[model samples]
Target: MSAKVSAGKQVFAIVKKDVLAELRTKEMVIAMFLFVVLAMVVFSQAFGVILNDLDRVGGGLLWVAFLFMSMLGLNRSFVHEKDEGCLEGLLMSPIDRPLIFFGKMLGNLLFLSIVELFAVPIFFVLFRLEMGASMAGIFLATIFLSNIGIACVGTLLSTISINTKTRDLMLPILFMPVIIPLLIAAVSATGGIMSGEELTEVYGSMRFIAVYDIIFLLVAYALYDYVISE
Candidate 1:
């Protein structure tokens, strides 16, 4: 019998299912956490004390770490789904497709948010860099918008990668080019904010991130059927 679940309920159920599965396995979260931390530490060592000077390119270093870390997290999230054939079952469900998209996105967002939350605080602690009000707000906005962009597109691209022989390496190759605008906007907005630039300076990048999210999310929703059908 088909269950009579609301759209919201279905989405929540999917999100909860993914979250609990991840929590139990703790694979994606732990992998992402360790990957990000290791990346940050390596960056710090490579850049040395230069990163401590917020006057230079500290913000850039942070974003670079995040950008790579996001890739690791995104790939892992979908890999988990693909590994157990869970995604196939999701497609078999009676729930709406967009619900699946949102559910997957929500699950990814949860992990990405957790990674950023922990990573950013540690970044500040290790780097000892303090951000201004505007920069702090921009930092928050970048994480929010970038996560949306990553989740929206990552879900589709991961599906694409799953069908490929090179599922592991294929994701970054396919996903990075597509998400360039997101990275550019996110990096620029973050850079401006960290440099204590005026809000007016970074607003355009913020707008770009917003528009990119809207456009990609819509396109992904429309194309998801095709992606998953294979």
Candidate 2:
């Protein structure tokens, strides 16, 4: 019980530290927000104005924007720590390494969620899409589940890529393939919701995402210490 409490405190401390630093700088969130908007504009133009097939393609476009925006944010998630030598200091601290992983994952999740809150509405408005009441809940659920998986795997890869000389170039390369399964599940589930499918229709994709989140989260948690050590 005491160990769990200590771990919880350590996690909170790291989260607080990162959040405070981000608030001061406002770098990652701003960049991600702008990138999301630009991607939306570009995608909107490429697809042009769709009259009938919006549901079929909207989900793919939405997740594409999320995928790139997340990569941009994940690439920077560890750069500041590496630049400031904070990564070393944190590693030397008495806190457990998995707690550090959780802290960083949560920080990334928070930033992504904030960006999505703004992005999703803008996406719906720009695409002239409307969601039924029931679909709204499922759409939000899909976003939450997908973000968890992205944050888990992205955090681990970010740590690994940060140590490389071409971290900026290497992160997306390492990140994209690992997240392909997640992107597929997210796009499928979201597309189903947008198409007004019944909850039962999208359950399979939802289950895949949940399983992906659990599996990668555990894998990342187990492997994080080694990733950070080197």
Best by lDDT: 2
TM per candidate: 0.91, 0.95
Model 1 score (lDDT)? 0.80
Give the per-residue lDDT of model 1 (tens digit) for 113-209. 8888888888778777787675676688777888898888887787788688988699989988998888878878877777777778689888989
Candidate 2 achieves a global lDDT of 0.90
lDDT (Cα atoms) of all candidates against the true structure: 0.80, 0.90
**What pairs collide in candidate 1?**
none
Error of 1 at 183 (Å): 0.9
